[model samples]
Target: MTLPVDLETDAARLRAIMAEDLAVRGVLDDPAWRAAVEAVPRHRFAPGFYLPGEERDGLGLTVWQPVTAALDPGRWLAAAYSDTTLITQFDGDEPDWEHPAERHGGAPTSSSTLPSLVVRMWADADVREGHTVLEIGTGTGYSTALACERLGSAGVTSVDVDPYRLERAASSLHGCGYAPTLAVADGVYGYWPEAPFDRIVAACSFRAVPPALVAQTRPGGKILLTLSGWLYGYARVLLTVSGDGTAEGCLLGGTVSFMSARTHAAPAFGNPAHWAAELPGEARDARHGPERITAATEEAFHLRFLVQSAVPGAQLATVGDVVHLVDVVSGSAATLTPDCEGGWRVREGGPVRLWESVERVVDVYEAAGRPGSESFTLSVHHGGQHLRHPRVPCLPLPSPEGRPGRSRTASGRTGHSSSQLARE
Candidate 1:
């Protein structure tokens, strides 16, 4: 028979090693944070996580196998301490934290984010000793515990849409002997009871900066989150709430992606042939190829972000060498096919001329000399929020460009298909 192992001793050693890696990699320069990183046991928060197994899901996810400390102390402890993301929720289904599962196909619904990233974002948000923070997406509550360590549990308020998530987080946090405020509420609205926070940091991504977050943040305070859309493009932004009840800042250069706010989650995309059959749009030769916006190349990645920025609710569908862009709301749609002459043919219809507007944005992007996201700024003012280069003309929000429908707007989710609308 195998003898039982001392888990706490091993966990402490792993924590020390993880802290050392962060410091050496420049992710944990703050001495206080480093202390917290070493002291807080992430394993207590995320005792089990899913790892990709032999099977694969076509959506770039995979067949995940659950690992828990009770089943395999060594592997579970290793995953808990690693610098990578550990999924705790699988496709909205909770993982069995004390059991082992060999394989199951599912997308990631929630996770313990990468430790390095967690530390980096906290540092970027400039979390300090006296700051009262509002943490969006409690998830595994690991980051919440980290903040509690550095700033004290009294100053931290965490919120999640799922009550079960909050329950687990509260339990795990209590296990760590720290009790920060945990709430079950939609993060989009911002936790009002704890208004005027010194820092509001999000683990989940949003289509735009939450207006409620702007109002609840004290003037000159910071709000950090990743902005993403159905196209699956992402941009990390750090906005400072101004005295004028507005916030604006440049996009952080690195790429960061997150699952949608459940309220904003989209459905799996389906065939566009039926949609095209319903709306026979005007036919014309197109100057630009839609392939440039959908390709997986790095250069195309930037363009994909720009296109998603320009058209918030548009969904992509590819069929038989043709690419389709459909705006679910307004019923606008565009289909593009490569022409025999090395050009592209297009058909677009509805309240908005989808392809025409896309071409215009691409034109403006090129005219601006193709500035990287670092040079681009995100402005959220009384009029509306817009992401664009300062010197360049505004990238018009959807409302002004076309008529509104029931589709998901930047302000909130009317909802759509993640498969159809969201890029993998």
Candidate 2:
């Protein structure tokens, strides 16, 4: 894809403007990072991408239209450098660059993460001179290029599960004059050939910090990631690997997410639960309102996060005045619906009583003064990682900021960036 000279001139100005915009927004403050942001021509990484169109199909899913640099250089360049995530592939693979599509509708599987987030994460990771880094989820290689610019190509190793994306990312990186070690491998298993990295930065989301990642990193190394669940809560945490094979960290505030790692992606379960038969559930008095756990309030994500920890795979939804919880992996489902007496009634089904556990956790959380993520601490071990709040019970666990007409910042592409459910 040959870009015109005018676009090249425009790209430099546009890149500088973007760097300044991030600086004003306070995401890009480091001089080296600023230089990397300014030096890289972003448009070269994403020659085409998908935009969600207004049209909807019979299933009520929005239609996605494709825009190419070849077809529309102005729109392509503006989008690439803008603080918007560009969807590059659909349903693991599509928008075939060779025979690119006119329009399509499916899940977005890969993307070029927006710039502010790209820099924010790198800054947060504390990437410094001579640090050997391993980046999971290569995506469009835009972030890879930035890392290479900050720390030369030989010091970086980036891997992705999608060969299609890696092929394109490799081309873009090499074309941009970067030769970072790129590989096709599952992110959960961090590429073993390059073990003992100083920093393991997972651009993708994982249900838990892969224990193998802990084993591969040198003692005192850091692992940066986002944890996602079936309920779609994404919490970013950074852990310092210890010499004793343990790690500890805390949740970083503000919402940000990424597509679930293909190895850890949520399964498709019809009716929201894995059930043998839809049996009428046992009814009981519901002491708590559904809004306590599922509202858009700041503490709501915390409450939902607690529920996810206790119940594991439970997915939450609502119908009329009723709030539903379903665990496709467990066949447990519960519905909290309003009754005539200005109170809610709980109906639960399946092998395990789902709502009972949720209610209990809410009681524990509310008693602890409804502490949000600030109180949350993430600790990892040879067995696995645990995200726990001091006052809450432990189970297991799981990105940021809004932009105009945008709601997420992807670290790299796996499912959809930041773990909030797109439909929710």
Candidate 3:
């Protein structure tokens, strides 16, 4: 049997690391933030075991230590202190204590987000004392603890979908002497029991902001969340609710990946083999227009965004002068191989194919001057029913210059595909 690890020593080291980092980063200047960071013992919230190398090093290196499979206090402390995500689930499921190995497989479904990200989010939300806040995604209850520390337990309400996670987190919070109302329900809907929140923050990422979250907040209340997109990174947006339940916030900075809430989870792509077997030979070598088209430009960025928005489950990859689009839904992955002088050939079943729906995006970009991200505008319409930004008027097809055409289209079309969107 594995022995239990010591918590006190580990907590001290973690405290030292966090304090040092905060001091160096100038985050320690905020008394409230500093106090919360110091007071929270991250290990208490991580009850399940984690391998030695599982922790994030914060320098683009992920060390996986499987030899020491069971949780260790020192390792846990370091992991808790680092600015990296600690995986809490595998294959859309949480860890099963009896089967420790099962915890490591598949994509991480949940985690106590990195400390830096959490702190940054709090900064974005502008959390203040006495403010009533609703926190979405209560993984390990760490962020909820911070909210509690900042706003007091009575002032914060947290919601999550997994009852087991909620129950475990409740115990951890109680053990640490902080108790907030914990609800085991979908966060996308927002907790109506604590409606009219002065501030709303989501630790999880959403493909699109749910109407319910906007409606539940009081006018002038702010909503902070990581908005998932096709780009390599996500945009953290901070919008304020209007009296009419509409909210608009600017994209803050950078991105982070989070598990999609159950309500917004990506649909599973059918068998890969099935997709590989269904390609027509002649259709495979379709023509992709020009080399300048795939080049990144502000205008081209808008075209790319349109393609991503239109096609659900499509992933873009640039390989050795060739661009590939892996369609998760149809199980068809296409590759567009650029010919010698910037022209290209489409390869179905590969990453990019010209005639395929994926290459159409490249054609659109080539048509555009390849503008940067600054030139576009994003607008949400349908009574705040949809998010259409960067691309004008939210139309499906591109204009002659590869820019999104006019808006004012009909209200509802179910928005973008959930599969292509990632949570942060």
Candidate 4:
């Protein structure tokens, strides 16, 4: 099939778009980042591609279009340069370029995180010239390329759990005339063959910072990552490795979802249809009761997050007026009854009550004045302990002057202010 645009022209156009977009957004002003953006050709990274408007049943459709490799250079370039996610692995496996049908079923396992998020994380890492860096989740090798542009190819080492992805990314990087030490290994272990890294960035999110990553960095080196938590949103954090290997840094911005490192990937919950059939009609109805809050633009995303978090292994479907939350962990199914009025009810499971959990999250959101991702704060302890709040100090509160006052931090830490955290 003939594509509408020439590859070189598309590549040039992509560079122009990215430069302009980042310039307008204030991300391209950093000369290092700007250089990296200019040097990487997104089309070379995504060999098989599809245009953005193409539709397929699931997430698989986006990754398997080799023809797109020639036709839609802009889509590939946009995906490459923009701060939006490009799905790389679906359900823990690399997409089979030979068979698109296999792409369905599992959730997204890896991606090149949005360009903006990567830039923010790089800024948080505070990487300097000649810094040795280790990047987790090499995906399409786009971010690795950026790191190479900043730190030099010799100073970077990139790793991923899937050997196929690593191999493919190695080729992509090589085609671009840049090469870093690429390895097929579990990212959770941190690549120690080249240890004492000055900076470490995880392209994937994790419930906790792997102790190995902290231990592998030089004292005072920065480790930037997305801290995963039960809350719907995640926090981009910057932690400094101490001589003792313990790390501490404050949250940098809002949240993003990334495939958990292989060791942390959530176990499969099994077939959804079977679980739906097993749910009791009453429990399902109660969970789907009318939503009490007004319908707002942000409600859908938050609602999806809460439902997925509350009902692990469940699939959520919104069909026009009704929302369906289905869980099929054991070939047994339960569903939440949809309330056209915006309420929820669970029609399955014993007294565990999935709907109640969702309602609780909704109540929290309402109490917080329906703040979107920006209004939340997340903090994590060294051992993976975490807390979330709609406001900050995250604990005991005091006035701006540091005097003990009636208002406490939402999470209650004294002498802390919520103003320190920013949203991405």
Q: Which candidate is the best by lDDT?
A: 1
Number of the candidate with higher lDDT, 2 or 3:
2
TM-score of 1: 0.86
lDDT of 4 by residue, 197-261 (tens): 99999987665667788879998898888754222234466778778656666655443556666
Clash total of candidate 1: 11
Candidate 2 residue-wise lDDT, 303-353, digit = tens: 676566656666777655657777665455787778898888877775556
Per-residue CA lDDT of candidate 3, range 152-252, in tens? 89998999888888888898888888979889988878999878898999987666677778888889988887654333224456878788756665555
Error of 1 at 415 (Å): 17
TM-score of candidate 2 to 2 decimals: 0.87
TM-score of each model, paired residue for residue: 0.86, 0.87, 0.74, 0.69
On the 0 to 100 scale, the lDDT of residue 3 in model 4 is 33
Off by over 4 Å in 4: 1-17, 52-66, 69-114, 228-235, 243-245, 252-255, 276-334, 339-342, 361-384, 388-424
Clashes of each: 11, 13, 26, 41
How far does residue 162 in candidate 3 sit from its true spot (Å)? 0.4
Q: Which candidate should be chosen as best, given TM-score against the real structure? A: 2
lDDT of 2: 0.77
How close to the true structure is residue 355 of candidate 2, measured as C-alpha lDDT? Answer: 73
